[model samples]
Target: MDMTLLSRLSDFEWRIEAHGKMRVPAILYASEELIRDMDNKVYEQIVNVATLPGIQKAAYAMPDAHWGYGFPIGGVAAFDPQEGGVVSAGGVGFDISCGVRTLLTALKVADVTTVQQPLADALYRHIPAGVGSTGRLNLDDQQLDEMLLNGAQWALKLGYGREADLDRTEERGCMAGARPEAVSEFAKKRQHREMGTLGSGNHYLEVQHVVQIYDEASARAFGLAPDDIVVSIHCGSRGLGHQIGTDFLREMVLQAPQYGIELPDRELACAPIESPLGETYLGAMRAAINCALANRQIITHLVRQAFAEVIPEADLSVLYDVSHNTCKVEEHMVDGHLKRVFIHRKGATRAFGPGHPAIPEALRAIGQPVLIGGTMGTASYILVGTDESERRSFSSSCHGAGRQMSRHQATKRWRGRQLIDELAGRGIIIRSPSSRGVAEEAPGAYKDVTSVVEAAEKAGLSRRVARLEPLICIKG
Candidate 1:
């Protein structure tokens, strides 16, 4: 990485030649400081991704790129099966479809403060959070399988939330290709009790107030009003996704060579798209996605119920739900040909710009809503996909203000109680089942989100529409 190997494409873009074992070059979008701050291993990971079978164009990294297991965390790669593509479990990460979802409430911030303490208490009492937290609703094996297959739709049928909520969600609240039977028993056991729960480490349920409006017209289109209190949940498929990633990495490593696949890096071990092992992993991964979607749906209902007990006027409606990790078959124009390819997004959100068929009819004109959750003590933003994004990237954007420090470093620098008091003095209420968890996600531990958003806008990945500040945060 230190060699004068990278060619500057623009002030915001850089290209690294794919010399050895690489089928294509690696493209990275970032500023000078952001790129220099990136770990050198990210360059190697991106090169490894470039060597992927049937890979199209080049492996690309978002402005928030960082070193990760296989592909850089903020990475995007596409494989054309027609050209003999392969799927890597590492590309999907442990938290399949781990993403952010925000809801717009009818009430304003002024209304929330009337019973803020009670509202927080009720949410804390009802919504399961923290490590190993379990929901009150227990499911038998058969019921769990049903939920895995049907996703949030299953939760809605069981009285968790309203049907209208699905409209704004990606894939209409359910990943279409889920196969519950393909999921392992161990994975099922771990996730059975975790449904509707927010697991620890950068996960939370927060009530925010829209503090700034960037695109006045788009904000109105998305039903976001300035100073409007909203709920944002950040979590994922939990143990089930972790278990699937673990199970497949072993299988893929063992069978990769058998499928005539060579590993540029062991962590990038993958299976041919046509192989049975690849199909099995996809099925189970999709099932885990369902668990995540259903999990958020159930939590939304719990949060709504909690509000009813206090404010009663808080009408929370779904804005959008999108995941940052996953590998899905998508149709993209590669080299002037319309082709079906498997696109892998790790720690990156899909920004389906305006007029794309995948977006819901209601939001098609305004494009997809991209929710970028900030550090616990910072501000989150809502952005819209621009048509230019699909052309510049593979419709990919940064997921958050990428971590600037490790959790251990963050916890070591900031103490829980003191951090809580500091935030409260700024009019931000912080509540958690664990304060240590609070310190681990200190806002200063991450890069400036405003800068990250600016980078995304400049890269044509996504354009900012509104900024949301946390009023009340419940950490897990």
Candidate 2:
């Protein structure tokens, strides 16, 4: 954040020149004020990422960047396998494939307001949430393997979600090359009951209404309009993903020396892309990605069930689903050469441009939908990917309003009960099993989302489409 440490490339871009063991420069996208407010650790982590083997172009931090395990929470980097590219567990974080999905509804703001509390209550009761929460559907070993192998496709075949929903999902609801055999039995055991549950910490199901439209064409393509009611679910692969990350991080750390990988930091532990450990890690990681997709698919069914009970006429349909915290194999142009590489996005969202074949055909004309969730009391934005972003940060954008303070710091500043009462006063209803969880995610605990989104747009990471304000929030 210190101006003295960076060379300004533009108002939104800053560069840290390559030095020491760094393989490339470090690039950051943020407004001056946001950069100043960002934790100094973000710079440290990003620079560390630049030092990793096989990293392409430069390591990048988004406007909402913050301190994280190894790669900054909003970091983006691509690695070339042919160049000995390594995949770091820290780069993908613990919550594998954690992401946001927004659902469109025929109901308007007025309709949701008529039964707001009851709807919130219904969602809370039906959708399992909070720490260690388990859902009605439990998977056995065979089913677990099937779920990991097929992802949301498995859910669809079981009639959990519509066939149309998969079209808008990243990787079409399944990351390819998932190997259930690669995942540990312990990881599978941890996930046996966690499916369809929204785990604790920064996960929630919110009912929102579009408050503003920035691009009419993009909005229309995304099936969004002012005053239109929508539901956004934020979560990931629960215990399964956490266990995989834990297992891999430790293995990478202990085995790094054997692979001739020197540690600038132990937390940045990684394995060469073509190595046995790396291949095994990728297989397991892809399974976790499927786990996350399957979990969201099942949760979507529960949400629709809730809606049917409360307002059957409300046509809730899939908008788009995208994940953060992933290392995906993608082809991108580097030095004017089209090459396939692994792109690591930690707390960053994929923002593929218009006409990208990877995106759903229905919305490809506009671009991939980038869902940005805000705190319980603030506004969330919906944006579309831009062509410029593909050339900039490997088509990556900020995931959310990054934390301005730690959970402990936030709890010190506000009480859960008081915060709930205050939000209720503003016509926002919140339901959570743990009041302390609400305190941890207090609005003031995060950077201003509007400012972060503005910086992203200005930096050509993505283009704003619509803004959404919460009507109800079911937190974990």
Candidate 3:
């Protein structure tokens, strides 16, 4: 984290020139304070990433970068398959397709306040949460495979959600190329009862209200106004995704030598993109992505039901849904030529700029909606991708206020019951199965979200749209 260790390119850009076995430079986008606060392991991991086979451009880290398994948590990199590119399981974290989705509600802040406690209790009762939580649906082997292959579309067929919701979702709620058979039987079993449940560790469903609008034009495009109520769901594929990552990471490590991959670190184990192992992993990974999308869609349906019980007239509509962790095939301009590449985004959100065909047609002029989640007590922000971001960092941005402390450290520093009481005093209701879970996610345990978002905007990664504050949180 030493300032002198990197070459300063600008206020928000720092670079480590390619050297030794490195194929390209490693770039970090952050303010001076944020860069100094980053752990040294982030620098080492990114440098390690630069040495990987077929890596393109550079290995970049966002403002919220943190040390992770192989690549840094807020890392971004692309690879070319024709150039012997590799697909790494470690590049995608255990919580595959972990992401956030926001729902626009007809009610405003004042309406929510009238039944805040009732609504909170209803959501807590309706939405299954906590470790090993089970939802109402229990799929058999055949049904599980269908869910894995079809994602939210499967849920919609079962009367969980409407068709319109797919238009606002990434990949239209079902990721293609998902080979359910590639997923292990044990992984499918683990997800059977966890379809609509919010798994433990940093996952939550919150009722939030917009408090500030940063860009009027973008805010209008996203259908946001001051004091409007919104619900945000943050989670992933649950046990299925974790098991897939575990299964593949172990296999990748054992098979790397056979593929002629000289791993800089055992955790960076990978197989060549064209290899059978790599293709199989991608198939299963894509299935997990669908699992996450289906899970979120089901949760949205549950949220609607909860609202109907408390405020019958309230209408909840999908604002946008986006995933953070995955290796996606995308086309990018490389050396003045448009080339296809695999983009790995770990703990980073895809922020496709305006006019990109990938973005939903309705929101294309403004850009993709980048949802940035905050802690239970802090404020979350909505940002839009910028054209400059595509050139700067592959149209990627920070996912959240990166953790500055471990869960153990957070538990030791704060008591959950007391913290919940404190949050309640500030008009935020907290509901969870475990008090320890609440303590583990103490707001002070993370970096200043406002500072992170400001750095991201200044770095041209994304532009802030609106700010949201939590009114009720159902944590896991």
Ranking by lDDT: 3, 2, 1
lDDT of 3 by residue, 136-173 (tens): 99899999999989999999999998898999999999
Q: For model 1, which pairs clash? A: none
Worst 10 residues of 1 by lDDT: 1-10
Candidate 1 C-alpha error for residue 370, in Å: 0.5
* Per-residue error (Å), model 1, residue 180: 1.2
Residue 221 of model 2 has an lDDT of 83
lDDT of 1 by residue, 1-476 (tens): 44356889888789998888899999888877788888888888898899888999889999888889988999999998778898889999989989998988898888987777778788888888898788887788999999999999999999999989998788889898899988999998888788889888888889999999999888998899898989999999988888988999889989888898888778888887777998888899899889999999999999999889998777889999999998988888888988888999999999989998878788889889999989768899999999887777789899998888998999899998999999888877888978888988999988888888888888789999999998888888
Clashes counted in candidate 3 amount to 0
The reply for model 1, stretches above 4 Å from the true place, is 1-3
RMSD of 2: 0.7
lDDT of each: 0.88, 0.94, 0.95
Q: Is candidate 2 or candidate 3 better by lDDT?
A: 3
Model 2 has how many clashing residue pairs?
0
